[model samples]
Target: MKENIDLFTNLLEKKYGVWNRNKALFGTTPYGKVASDLSISSSQFSKLLYGTATEGMYERTLNNINRLIERQSIEKAYEETQLVINKSKTAYRKRIYFFSILFLGIGLITSYLFDFNHFAFKLSDYEKHPLKSYFYPESSMFFDSPFIYNNAISENCPCSGFEGKWKLSESFKLPLPGMKKPGLYYQAKSADMIIRCSNLFDSYIDKGHGMMGYEHLKSEIWIDTKQEPLVPQYFNPSSKVFTESFKQLNFESDPRFKKIADLAAFNVNMFKIHGDSITRNAELTGRLAIDVNKKLAKKYNIDIGYIVKNVLGDLIKASCKTTFNPFCNPNDLSEGISKISFDCVYTINEENLGLNEGYPYTKSYLFKDQVFSDYLPCECEDN
Candidate 1:
């Protein structure tokens, strides 16, 4: 643990350079911002550095630090590899140009001597191999350069800025507890847009579908930020963002929607506390559980307790897939859980919330429901 802590400190120094506590609190420093991203407090981060933190905190912090280290290593390696490839490509182009001129001169001499002008001059008419296949191909060949073969990325790549904005649907406050000043802010947005657009561009440029010209493919290159913001439905409490996204459609009238949003906010507030906070979550869940039940019960004027219980129960079961136990003990939220306990639960809760608002189950659509279906794909999968 001490070794890992030292490594983490070294990494911080190398990545962010040295920070001065006299100038700023550790929590307010760029180095401290990393801890904030992991939902660790300044004191806890201090404890982590000094090897005085709990075993769980140590392990979690070490894992995140290791992740940071690994990511940086990969990025550095990629930049180096690209540099080499670019150099090789320049050399290769020069060689190809020299050889092409030599071949053309030889052909012209042979044509003049043998009266084969028809064949030699007609070299310009030789059909060119498709650019996609000649340069970058779906599958690599023996003579292909490292650049061509390396086109496929093992992990998702970020999209170019020209594509459009991919924003998070929900915004959250930082998880730092008891700070005198306002804490950092965060949001949950899609991180895989780059890879998605890359694949799309490959399809377009490669003429994967045999499209004729750029006019037909112009619209496909850009994503409409207003119509489709590419916000994912997953929950990530530690994420911090400096920018804001544009407005999106909201179904604030729905009780379930409000409940899910509130629960998400509550979970973000409770992230990394790992103690009595579970009780607070339980209390919040209890209220939400009752609120949702009451709305359903009053709307249908029938006994919906059993249905609501089963639905939330199923949600809890699904959310606990990574845990030792399959359910959150109402009496003790901290009993057996790992990671953010209530994130996935509320993320999916809004899907069933539409029932309270008089729509069929989320998968299906009713008349004039295209608006909901179009705007919110999470609740309506068919859209």
Candidate 2:
């Protein structure tokens, strides 16, 4: 695929000079003009160059691209191709859904369209507002340093040379297209700060994997800044109160961490109680011509659950990051602070466990068995 891409691009460049995506778009300087031809702003366009773009593309659109480019690479042909590219980019831009920023009116970045759907707060004003930065990047900065990480995920951390930044390539579940990175290891300090800080990390409990049942599968803890003093009175869970009470998260307090522990305990109990039901009803509401025997599928699914649970338990060796966004956000989430989210699958050796291979095999088989989707296969076979 990359070869074909290079070939097509080389052909265009041969006809025209080095093809400038920015010049072809708005016919202006490279700085802001890159975003003008399409819905992706200048920053996003740059990130695309940075190889941090998402892997969402349409085959129809890709096919249409061939017809749109200049055949001869002549000046007039280039103009025509440019117009076609502009239209194509704009068409693709409409499909994405960005998370909304908290301060909508405050213009933070270069383009309005790019920053429109981001969850951003002023780096300076963050003490006043709370953010769930663990799930997604903030509008301005990421909390780093003095992070209290569970011992399960923080062994021999930061690896070797990767100290300056927390979010490194080593932690990525799936590496992005750009440069390779070394992981940054964060350590928690017993300092003047409290459990929660003026710095905030996002809190979102993602539901179970396909047919895995609805429970929080991931628990992420992103460092914000120096912790604020722990205040027990602010235990309320409102949005505004979320900000004020953010300081209540205490690292030393065993009871304080119980909220997270409860989530873990709940997941374990659900697995025990509904283990059969989850595997049994993986494919639900599908009417079949004949009754499909799900005994084997149920067995495979149960085995797969163990694989996942064990893998989740193996966070000790994997990089302690929850998500991997290499470059800064369109709205600049880093606020100049190096950002990295810390998380763990917990207690397993990656070399010993072929969970890498086991994961894909288990996940795929379940889907084929209709364990993750709404459709049911008519025939069930023994593998």
lDDT per model, in order?
0.31, 0.25
* lDDT string, candidate 2, 1-383, tens digits: 45444543443343334757756522233435424422346665454444444433222112222222322223477789888767776546554322234244444554455552233322212221122243224543655533223331123111111111111212122101111121111111111101111111011111211111211121222222222222234323232122333333443352322111100111110110111111111111111111112343242222223322443333322322223423211122222243323333222343533222221101101000110112112121111
Model 1's lDDT to the true fold? 0.31
> Which run of 10 residues does model 2 get worst, by summed lDDT?
360-369
Candidate 1 error regions (>4 Å): 1-39, 89-383
Candidate 2 runs further than 4 Å off: 1-296, 299-305, 320-347, 355-383
What RMSD, rounded to one decimal, does every model reach?
Answer: 23.5, 26.1
Model 1, 1-383: lDDT tens digits are 77756665665564456745566433345646867765568898888777787776665554455345445765799999988877787779799889999999998888677754455334323322223243335666564532202233212111110111111223322111111221111122111110012232231122111111100000000111122212222212234211232223222332222121111111101111111221111111221221222442343333334433443333222221112221122112121121222332222233543222111111100111010111111110110
lDDT of residue 306 for candidate 2: 39
